[model samples]
Target: MARISTKSLTNRASWLVLRRNRIMTIGETVGILRDNDDFLVVTHIRPDGDTIGSASALCYALRKIGKTAYLYNNPQFGDSYPWLAEPYLAPEGFEPKYTVCVDMADKGLYPEGFKGSADLCIDHHPSNSLYAKNTLLWPHKASCGEIVMELVKELCGLDAEVSELLYVAVSTDTGCFVYGNTTGETLNAASELCFAGARNAFLNKILFRTSSKARLALEAQILSSFLYYHDGKTVISVVTKEMLEKAGANEKDCQDIAALPGRAEGAFTSVTIKEIDENSCKISFRTNGLVDANKVCAMFGGGGHKMASGCTIKMNSFKAADTLADIIGEEYK
Candidate 1:
């Protein structure tokens, strides 16, 4: 109604140009840290390398600065990722004043039953709704950890430990620097991380090299049950409870193999359903650029980026698949 302050208007104009790098002002970030010394960090569910890397890296930095930091326990990720489980791992009995979720744009993305106030949300996802009270958003950055690196450098000052963790964070998000999103700035950050003592070969082996016997078995089963629908325009994969038990596979294995079908030639969309329990299933969706899987997923109460998303289904697996196909077909047509 009244005239807006010139300084305030100027700041907003500059930010629209900066776009995705629109982070909280330096003063605002300092105020957030001043409000708490102890924090617990978590990431999006079905934690990927970027989410784990960002969350754990920040945890390490907080510890180095003599602050109490903890990471959420992931029982499903289990002992296989012992290296991840040990670093700045969340304390069992520590109840912190705040929880900071790294790389998570939406609170719905957190694991079930994780109850606490969200103090801050750090991410670069364009769909973010700013759910946290204090948000440091950089939707233009290559990875969430790139934003984390800036915070560490500006707030606490960066070091070898921070850089190493962030290297994992950024590298994973860039698809080892091969993805289309890699930019000159991304490479510059990575080169500095190398100087700060990030060991690429070692981390790469730990992250991309290992596969358990169960994982291999799950792969075979997925190959066997692989299906094509819509005249090969769509792909469908079903993992029954028996198939999982026979392969000695768990949820992580299914999550690992979920993306394969989407890459098939002529397939515009892919759908994978895992029997979560008797009457419920977990559905993961992926698509080529021609299809917007997010729209299909949102019809069932889930939402994500345009090409990939997921939703849980209360109906039996067949019914879920049929219902999902109906939604997807409409968009593709």
Candidate 2:
């Protein structure tokens, strides 16, 4: 695939914004939700706050409008944001008139064996696959949650549940509003949610300020395995399944671990490799503004935001680590 220039990417976003008749708007989306009695919202495979919050908020807003809505079953839900997803699980074989996917850029990101197509896709990734029949994509937005907020506003459902859910979605994706993606619009959306009853201080403590013992131990093990290259301009960290076992940690305890290597002093690019199996691993790339992490991950058929992206490699963890480091360094060389 060829690299997309900033000019072309910006033009694509602007075109989507102007061609509202082709892509669905918040009002059109609301009309769909209102007309459909049975709605099911699906998040990405490895659930994150943005996906979970966006789906959960959409489900809640649908229910508030007296529509039947449920969250699709995601195995990783319990690991990330259980509170937001617990009460919304779709019952077994619940047929949905409208199957909507939130925060999923590619169809491959949907859970395994989910063969049905989505009626709509709501997302913020610049590289969205446009796999749905109708898409509401705002690449300029910091998080899908920000777009969800617009839907909630149009539906007149800006209560505490919606507020806090959007807060989680926006905050997690933007790294508590400190990431390069964070813009004035993002902060303003967060402020509105706060005024509407999002407990920002409390959520900040739970999501950022606090960590469990297992998580701390896992972090220590990962840090111990950190490797540097390119004169410390590139860094890599590994966390094997055995390491997680030794730390008494599971998937839930490894939240934000991918960003650990990038926080190193003088690091320009970082990679985190997590062993999913003996022969395969998941790799995440983080960059400090100059190198586009999306471009690095795209080399492996994966892409996300410019600063953060990920892919899965069918190679041993150690080899995957070395390969990712080499590719990232080569990209910036």
Candidate 3:
């Protein structure tokens, strides 16, 4: 496996042309995998089960097929998904000949301080920025794990470990098959993974059935902070730095916190604003089909699927919540 060098102007132009031609089909992606060795898989910032599971599963599949693979040590990888990605983490100073990003929608979502571009991107986000040299995108799939499952099936048969990891990827992104984004295809893939020895019941119990005390407290604060607009159709919940402090919560405890406001019976559009700093807030938007969450998030230059999307607002949590409320409220008029 020879590494492609971009040391000269001519080689750089050639690389660009090669990349343009490499917006690949699944078969082409499989071919790339079979031909490459020494891979480094990258997860997105604020690593979730989907990103971690997909990257871990891909690394397992790659290594199973006799390729050397490791996962990039994402800075935001807290202890949230304990031990799941630890075995695959790349050692210090290891240089990969090929870089693969899984479940990442864009280069901007790359783990903090990650440099250079990916050789391949496997993602299911409709808003994918196509930042990789080669991309295998399935915008209609419920999770990037589904795409990775296909790749693994093609590369090497799915073993129990890979199946379990992919189950994590699929189930988490779809909110344990309860989110509106889940489809028949998603269920079918999950079923197949189960047949391949995925411990669905055990995984479901750990991932969904359990919650920490801090998580429960954070949910309480989020629910109490909800501000309704548009006759209860649009709800915005603010989680200030103080709220996290009060709840004894950290980022790990705040996973899926955005879904709290959307659980309100009459809310069609829900927004969760988390204070990142005094001047900036991270926004997560969810909709029950009445409004496009992607479009709403795009107002602040972010996007994802129609049912769930997110963005960052250059305002305090309260201001960002009010601003998003106004924006969502106007949609009903």
Name the candidate that leads on TM-score.
3
Question: Relative to the unseen true structure, what is the Cα RMSD of model 1?
Answer: 5.7
Better of 1 and 2 by TM-score: 2
In order, candidate lDDTs are 0.73, 0.86, 0.87
Model 3 C-alpha RMSD vs. true structure (Å) is 5.3
* Between candidates 2 and 3, the lDDT winner: 3
Q: What is candidate 2's lDDT per residue for 131-219, written digit by digit as tens?
A: 78778888889899999999988886698878999999999998898777889999999999999999999999999889889999999
Please identify which of the two predictions, 1 or 3, would achieve the higher TM-score against the true structure.
Answer: 3
lDDT-superior candidate, 1 or 3: 3
Tens digit of lDDT per residue, candidate 3, span 187-248?
99999999999999999999988988988888887787789888888888888989889889
lDDT of 1 by residue, 26-110 (tens): 4566467656777888777777767777888778767666778888775544523436547777767878887888888778888
Q: C-alpha displacement of 294 in model 1, angstroms?
A: 2.2
Superposed by TM-score, candidate 2 places the C-alpha of residue 270 at a distance from the truth, in angstroms, of 1.5
Q: How badly does each model clash, as a count of residue pairs?
A: 1, 0, 0
List clashing residue pairs in candidate 1: 71-90
